[model samples]
Target: MTTSPPASATPALPEPTPTQSEQYSLTHGKLTVGDYLPKASHDGKPGAGKCEWSSHVSVALTSDEIGALAWVLIDSVMKARFGPAVQLYDVWREHTLDGTTIPEPDRQTIGSFVKPVFGLPGADKKKSKDHLHGHIGEWLWHLLTKDNPTVRAQPAPKGDVTDSGGDGYTIYETANSELRFRLWESKKNTGKGSLSTSLNQAYGQLGEHGQTYVAKIVGAYAQASGEGAAELNSFITEIPRAWTQGDVIVGAGVTLATHRPLPNKPFKKMAGKLPLLDKPGQLRGLATSIECYEELADTVRRYAWTAL
Candidate 1:
């Protein structure tokens, strides 16, 4: 099943022209951002405090655009686990350096490296679904955070196997020049289940294990020797306390592929789920419902293999 904007809505934008780059870059101007939940409903609400409603954005993309995005992002996805200097990155840079097409042999080499990371094309059904859906959700959140101007987010750690910890992290600079850290957990609902239930699970996981997740990523912050590095490191070092002190923002988001209409209040139950961060602008929720999600995942996988 597929869902698209109504005829009265704005016309679909033209596809973007691909740019030549040494490193993978996000294809901007293609994502459609709109309100998923109303602001009036959240006012003075328990789980929904006075957070930046604008910050809670929803994204929609055409199938072709999604496939192209996967190609553009494959390098960064590879680098997330293998580092920036991976052989595949080198091969891509070399090919695009002269505006020439990558040779067939080179494409094969790229596919070889990519297939193992994502799993063979026709691998086990359960494992393949898990890898594809989980990575796609994380990737969507990464793109959203990167495009957001108010926060500087880290790329998700793309491990070959699932690991315990938060799904995403970011730093927000308040108007007062204070640094605030955010830990995010992302979930995807591929089954015929409730989106709120998935979100509740994400919040529960974060409430129980968010500290350990923050602790593990403290070293990654050390690489930021630029301004605010010291303060950021200190904030991350004190996890649960930082969350309590209003210096840390905890968020959870769920992505679903559905043809059904979304609930008017997707995140109404958030405050009751995890009441630790009840301050205004402290608890955040994102709900991304896409049409043909499983098909998109398959398309993304195909595009990734041919991205050389």
Candidate 2:
């Protein structure tokens, strides 16, 4: 067998020359959206004020682009659950300080949607209000404006820090556990629900065996029948993090309407969506292959896996 080249000077990812479509990854704070909802937030229930917390995602794409992504989000939602939820979010981004609305002519590109989760061994175990819908807005603002880098937690605790504060949701993570499109931590209640407890509580609702793909596209809240993914015994699995290394990411699913489903494509398209786990000899090298990363993403998109 041919020996791999000496480990040195891996080629760097090419910097794409500036294009109108590529405007510095569109920092949320700089964009009209940030003026509306600057950071990931727990704005709590929906309201009549400029912002609404109904199930949704805050996308950074133009109107047309939103439509394409919406289509895909809807597709993934359908495949994940029996069908789409009662309402979908499109149009009506929060109003900016200057009192202008960020046009979401196609509002479906922020990311996937998730259902409101409830019913675990020790959770309240009661139905919540319609106000509890879920969300999945882009972490654009934080990565663009905030001095601190965006964060993500890994396996056992597996989630990307797609947190753009002021928007109302963040994802917490774990190994073999499905990532949570989380709510901003609340200092209001303390007991089983300080920040850490509340997160763990929400995670358990998805159930250990669920492969449901239905999640709110922008913010959390969609209580329906379903199961939770897995749970890691340790509170500290892979802690929250950011991408220190570079990797490529490609859209796995399709986009549609002003809103669509999220990624859940075949295995070979979404692997590097997050950091890879370096399992011994076999699982190590494959991490570098985009196809493998894509496959890994596809494999886990359904639901977090549980130990047998």
Candidate 3:
């Protein structure tokens, strides 16, 4: 593991102007895309309208990359549902009778939990929207943290429950040496108005209810058993020393322009029309436009059933 730098260390800032955009291949080649026009510096101590802000644009994902990413995402869903140590037999046994009887409603849901990526999931009993949000939340988590080992899945609550402020949460030690906690919320929409509504709600959670949510996730992981548990406990236990007051950050993943093709309007133009939760310094944003959303669902379902 790369040792985190001292909290006082000056963290490397994003390029004010990325010449050709930054390309990355993640999830073992499951995702390959570029981040363009990144704005790292914030004006006036990190609030809106204080700095020269530019929203970054993501290069459209290829079919293969999207397929691969779906696999990784579905794998995460399985892990979140069944724990990271889950196996092929475990999935097979739980969803099947004997060894060949597939459950009804749709075999694809079960297959979605373990299959390989071909396309995204289709509707099943009116739960497709919720399912899509869950997968996208996990996918966003992996994208932001690069699948940090310490990141744990927040199991889906049993029964018809709600009020979970965010879709997912995790804590990591920043290279700047501060232990930073991030709360993730993903919103999927096809149009700008609906997407903005969702994005605003997510931002609202991060702004108004962020601290309490952070405490809840910290408390849960602190008591849980895992390789990350000890470190997580230590970080939460010593919150005073781990971070200066008001140093935490919030992030949101918004799916925009989904109704249209890939490479939608530049991030700046879209972002200009949207509300800012706070200063760019305290918030991070991942704005994406998923072109083949239905295919993404199918791909996730495919990976869930196909991969061990």
Models 1 onward score TM values of: 0.69, 0.18, 0.54
Model 2 has a clash total of 78
Model 1 stretches astray by more than 4 angstroms? 1-63, 73-76, 79-82, 90-117, 122-127, 219-221, 244-260
Candidate 1 per-residue C-alpha lDDT over 96-209 given as tens digits, one digit per residue, 9 for 90 to 100: 344355689876666555664466444533454766776766766565556566674465645542765667777776667655677777777777777767767876777777
TM-score of 2: 0.18
Per-residue lDDT over 97-156 for candidate 3, one digit per residue giving the tens place of the 0 to 100 score = 122445463454445444222233343424434445444544543454454454443344
Best by lDDT: 1
lDDT of each: 0.55, 0.23, 0.43
Better of 1 and 2 by TM-score: 1
Tell me how candidate 2 scores on lDDT: 0.23
Ranking by lDDT: 1, 3, 2
Give a tens-digit lDDT track for model 2, residues 213-277.
11222222222233332232221122222111111110011101112222222112212221231
State the displacement of the C-alpha of residue 163, model 3, in Å, after optimal TM-score superposition: 6.5
Over 4 Å off, model 3 = 1-66, 88-130, 148-163, 223-232, 238-280, 302-308
